[model samples]
Target: MNQQSTLSSSDMPGFQLKALLLLGLGHLVTDLSQGGLPVLLPFIRESFGLTYAAAGAVLMTSNLTSSIVQPVFGYFSDRWGSSWLMPVGILTASLGFSSLGYAPGFWALLLAVFVSGLGVASFHPEGFKAARFFTGKRRATGISIFAVGGNVGIALGPLLAVAGYGWMGLKGTLVFLVPGLLVGIMLIISLGWLSEPQRAALAGISDGSRQGPRPLGKRWLPLLLLILAVTVRSLIHMGIVAFVPFYFVDVLKAGAGTAAKMVTVFLMCGAAGTLIGAPIADRLGHKRFFVGSMVFLLPVLWAFLAAQGMAAFVLLGLAGAVLVSSFSVTIVMAQHVLPDRLGMASGLMVGFAIGTGGIAATVLGSVADVWGVLRVLQITAALPVLGLILALAIPYPYKEAGQSEA
Candidate 1:
């Protein structure tokens, strides 16, 4: 790569910085709408008098629906290449999320989340494929830039929910609709921006083919192992996000504001880790970076369990950073494994793997009911060990050809 190629400017081949920024912004709002739901869970529980199990059920419903549909969308994008999906996805997500305020009852709330989840599901496959093209040769850097939008949005969710719910109660969720609509309109207008570059410059990492289909028979073991690794990470992530506030408030006797702030701190630091780790992974090799991150997360989580107050907060932030660093790396690895199926790979890793984790959140909630949430944290701390084991099994790209390991 030359100086000009690394610049990420308008002149760089396949590097449309402006279009990427817009697509990233679109991703930001899409996830912002999704991320706010967990923040709203405690408030919703108190207002509706629901159990931890019920709350977990809500998350399960949303995650499962979103998980199940995303691969279908990815398959379509791979086969037909739809420009309308992105804008429509945003619109659908916005409307579904805005309905949370006046849902009236538990079933209605479930329906709202299901619809909102579908919207979330609709955006990722095509959105990620676009992000891939917008970066050209710098897929890692470009995907990181695009992924940071979701990272920031998810990080902001707790703070936004606290502020919105504090001021306007449940109805405050309607505020998300404004950004959703605005971004959707922008995506519609910028359709040409994504389409043009993809046609002109988009190419696969493993092979130089552009939008060409290829066989996947040789890649099954690696892809399955990759999905399992990603699933474990996502499971730990959603488990913490869904239950940590409850643990802080009920077990630690912390104030609601403090608990929300702690969650925000974790997510924000994770966003920082994504930005810092992506470029390094590009240079140092994805497998090493991912396995090392999971390795570091093990002790950090133990320290988080033992620490108190501000110390706990700091440890939590570190844990978030290490756990999240592999997110984009996993997605990019999936793409490398199935160069012709970028959309499917994106959906499988980003959507389905996350959905599987969301399903596990309910299981975690059930265990919490039996063993207590604090004990659950102790068990959860050991999860990274499993992730590290799987990370080690992720095959080197050149392993089959007897090339030197990365």
Candidate 2:
């Protein structure tokens, strides 16, 4: 590595709050479309008279397109700069999802969803990579802020969709078009400034002077284990989000309103956890915090499933926080392990791994059909054990000087 190419501590910029917040805003808008899709399923089903399986395929189409194609976009971003993708992606996603209400046929609906999914896929890799550069020394903290924006967007998506439907029937989805356009244009104007850190970081990576030696022994092994851990976490996350309302309404016999509120509370708590956990992880070590959160989650989730009333609510909130606290930690760890492939690492962590877990959660629908929602909840509760083991096995180089600082 050339001395000039190396980025010393002083050479690297400190946390750029404005840039991170802008990236976070982009994240929120991108995921809002994703979050809104599931809530619209029932209405779509009602309108089209489709079977449950067919309606599910709508979400599956979106998830598959958005998640699977992310790495390809990340590759492009790595090979060539991608600041423009952020604005283009936001507009495309907004346009596709907004048109959902007007699709004349089932296939048209899928096409719109697919387009929106592509937009979602395009935004994440570069968004995450830029978030990393903007945060500088506070990678975990900055990433958590960015991750929390997605969490809040997902939590709010259903609310916004429902409101739109209530106000103007299905066409209410058009309301999303406003934010997409506004934010997309804002990002475009900000591009020149935003690309500065990214150009520097890319230069460092390309020059082979970013950090210490890459991990040894099957370079992919560490990343594979990390992905497995993220997948398990996503499985539990998506499963709980998908099934918990049913569990509350059917088994616990809560009111529909209460059930809805529980989901919101759970998601909000997770967002809170993301903010609270990252700074601590920065000090305690990202891997250590990640593993500890997983270990703690198993018991908390089980108790939440078993308890009732106030106790159950407390446990549920705690479980959400503990489970989600590690979300940004895993992304940071992935980028650390694959420093040269930062964009791909971001895509795998935020896209493929999480999306795979969501797709796998659909299997729980089968479990709910054959056994019951309670059985599904039990299975969901047990998933963290696998995540814990994978976290333990990640082969994270805690002793490396570069890693230690990260």
Task: Report the C-alpha displacement of residue 240, candidate 1, in angstroms.
Answer: 1.3
Writing each residue's lDDT as its tens digit, candidate 2 over 37-145 gives 7666657877988754565567678878888788888877766767799999999999999998888899999999999999999998988877777777888998999
For each predicted model, how many residue pairs clash, with residues at least 3 apart or on different chains? 0, 0
**Which parts of model 1 have CA positions greater than 4 angstroms off?**
1-12, 200-212, 398-406
TM-score per candidate: 0.92, 0.89
Candidate 1 per-residue C-alpha lDDT over 188-230 given as tens digits, one digit per residue, 9 for 90 to 100: 9979867664444333312343324545666788999988988
Please list all clashing residue pairs in model 2, or write none if there are none.
Answer: none
Pairs clashing within candidate 1: none
TM-score of structure candidate 2: 0.89
